[model samples]
Target: MDYHNPNYATSLYHFIPSPLFLGKQIAPNAFQTTPKLHILDLSGNAGCLPEHPELSSMPELQELYLRRMQISVFPAEIMSLKQLRTLDLSQNSLQHIPQGVKDMTSLTQLDLSDNNISALPPELGMLEPSLQVLKLDGNPLRSIRRTILDRGTKAILKYLKERVAED
Candidate 1:
């Protein structure tokens, strides 16, 4: 319907750094009004905000874009979105690939490119059955050779699964 109505706001494209709005701009209870929200873009809001606890409230979200948000800690709360299909956390300061990611069973595409990530969790193998795309380019992965990553999704996933079986 109308964008002004909180119930109708299904998508929000906020380029302004979220730190400026934390606690001051958004009322703590405001997120409850939009239960249908599916897409959220807060890309480029880097450094100022480290952890966003508010995202957990939006369980209906499907596509979440947080590129360059500088979130070092994965918000396990965001994993509450069982409907999530695409998650873009590229170009941030993340180092570890969080375990909670395996719970997003509906995910088809996940982007974690261009970060400081040095290794990956074998639990990533669990996503192979449903995950259609996973972008891990630009990370300094040590365990898996760059040659395997260049071979693409099937190769990378198979390599991770093999590692899991060996462990």
Candidate 2:
């Protein structure tokens, strides 16, 4: 269920256990405030836009979870969070990486698993300089062959080197 009101500061939203939702549109400016709101959890709510109300203008927001939301495109405006460090968009319906994601230089952990993405944008290498953990297991990418994994650190090192050089 969706709740909307100008004076309401904080409220508990319902948990929808449905696996798929299509065509749900959330009001974008319902939680407008001065100090900034932090932490948003929209998991299990598939088809909800990542750029929903209260999320786009939030200045202090740090952690965001849109996993299993069946999102296809990422919003470029989310890059405005200079203080943002964690983002989880796994289990969605994405097919490509959003170009604006490269703007998030402070991100540490990224979860992109369980999606239909087949290839990563070459610019993703730019994130190698700051990223600590990357989750890309469920993608349909066919380039990373098992032989590459057998090569161990050398393979990863080469991948990183190429990524850094690509920048």
Best by TM-score: 1
Error of 1 at 144 (Å): 0.4
- Give lDDT tens digits, candidate 2, residues 1-167: 33466434544232233444445655566435523556766687765653654555666767778888778876566677766767788988888876667678877777788888776665555666576666776788664565653564345335745765767
- The residue ranges of model 1 lying beyond 4 angstroms of the native Cα positions read 1-30, 47-52
* CA displacement after TM-score superposition, residue 23 of candidate 2 (Å): 9.2
lDDT for every model? 0.74, 0.64
What's the TM-score of every candidate structure?
Answer: 0.81, 0.71
- What TM-score should be assigned to candidate 2? 0.71
